[model samples]
Target: MTDMQHKPNGWNLPINQMTEEEWKDYFECRKKYDIKLSDEEIKKIIKIAMHFIDTDHDKYMEESLKIPVPPNLAISYKAFNGLKAMKKFNLSLAKETYPDEF
Candidate 1:
């Protein structure tokens, strides 16, 4: 979020954990910028995300317990998944849009 031009107060905190003031800031910040995804793109993300959750997540969690400190696995996993989705989406979109670049 360091790269964000506008971010809510306590953006690092989970939505349910946020204060009312932070929620207000969040809504206001949301109005400042938007990245609209196509319906197909959204569906693509959903499919990819669900596949990970259904197929790989259990194994990932099982393996993670081997580590003494997984650094807030719930939050870390969500963030990692989000970044992974973004990277996959970007790579896919970029490849289709700029085939020559690859």
Candidate 2:
């Protein structure tokens, strides 16, 4: 198997090995900047972090879904999938909403 095959979705971060401090850091970074880490972004980040936390992916995802989407943003089904999926759907939606962005 290739390297990607050994990794979850070819993620680069070692999230499964995070310490409590790192977990706090992650949230702090997210909150400090008021970053709207969308569902997709959050999912990817969680996958990486969970790798560091050495937790179950399904449990992590389930727990994450309960966190709620950011205010003022509507989540498309595509975002629930992954980055690429969300990109395609988001791009199309953006075009539909603001053709000028295309």
> For each candidate, what is the lDDT?
0.37, 0.37
Residues 1-102 of candidate 2 have per-residue lDDT tens digits of 112223223223342333456444433432333233466876786566576445576665544443334322323332344322222122323333432211
Residues 1-102, candidate 1: write the lDDT tens digits: 312343323344453344556445444433332233576755665566565665698654433322222224323443444322222122223323332221
Error of 2 at 53 (Å): 0.6
Clashing residue pairs in candidate 1 (N, C-alpha, C atoms within 3 angstroms): none
Candidate 1: list runs displaced more than 4 Å: 1-20, 28-34, 55-102
Candidate 1: residue 71 Cα off by (Å): 36
TM-score of each: 0.26, 0.23
For model 1, give the 10-residue run with minimal summed lDDT: 83-92
Pairs that collide, model 2: 15-48, 15-51, 15-52, 16-51, 16-52, 16-53, 17-52, 18-52
